[model samples]
Target: MEKILVVSSNKTASETLLDFLRGSFKCTPKIVESAYQAKVHLNSDVLTELVMINSPLMDESGVEFAEYVTENTTANCILLIKAETAEKISERAEKAGVIIVGKPFSKAILYQIVRTVDIAVSRSVELYLRNARLEEKINEIQTIDKAKFMLMEYKSMTESEAHAYIEQYAMNKRKKKSIAALAIIDKLSEQYL
Candidate 1:
């Protein structure tokens, strides 16, 4: 279930929103009265998926909390503000990459915002995972190249010959080329060190 942190001081509003979120999204939402309390939840390794910051957080505007969340965490945020403050709130929200939910919003609108957040979060995660895989591939290629260079220099083998040697070893041992390359690099390291 998605975990949501709600920063709001109004007990009635918080409770009402929590019920809506729970019923509509099956979200696990927790309420805090201040941005500081929200920070406490963030620092506690809660892995909150979304943060909903109600404008006029005890002593500060929700924009401050939203900005903090944007800078400090990967969680998506929805900043709720009064229509009168929409202009200011929207500027801050734009800078912080937060979604805006104007106060007195309809249930349908809130649900739509939550759905958009879910889609954005999923896309962010997918992009992150793809980048991680690409990085791993780059590292493997670098390691294999280093191993090939070592073989070429020490054993007087051509580049293709060194690559073929590693491939053959990997095939025979039922290992990946990256694994075989690491073993070769380890052996070379002992001699060079």
Candidate 2:
């Protein structure tokens, strides 16, 4: 489930937002009356995917908090502000990756904005995971290459022989090629160095 945080000071606005978000997204959002409270929640280890801020929060205008969220967390932020102020700050907020929504917006508009942000967040996470896997694969390949080189230099084996040795060892032990490479490296290093 996506964790959402709503920061608003007005009782009526927060209640309306809670209802709309709960009804539309089918998720419960944590509501905080001030940026300070929101920060406390955000600082925790739990990952929050979305942050919706109603402008004129009791502590501040909420733009700063929106920027803070964008800078500090992976969560997508939507800042609801007066139409006039939104126009003035939209560029700045957008540069920081915060989506600005003008006040007096219909439930449909809010839903659309949230949906768009959700799609963006999902894509971003997918890309991040993909990149991490690629990096891990690259590291494993490098480790295997290093082990192969050590075998060629210290064991007086040809490149093909080193490769075959590692492959045979991995198959025999039912372990990954990288794990076998690491074991070879440890044994050769201990024996030679």
Local accuracy of candidate 2 as per-residue lDDT tens digits, 1-193: 3699999999899999999989988889999999999999999935999999999999999999999999998788999999999999988998999999998899999999998887887888899999999999999999999999999999999999999999999999999999999999999999999
Highest TM-score against the true fold, candidate:
2
**Model 2 superposed RMSD (Cα):** 1.4
RMSD of each: 1.9, 1.4
lDDT by residue (tens digit), candidate 1, 15-61: 98899888988777888999888999999955788999887888687
lDDT of 2 at 103: 83
Q: Which stretches of candidate 1 lie over 4 Å from their true place?
A: 171-174
Model 2, total clashes: 0
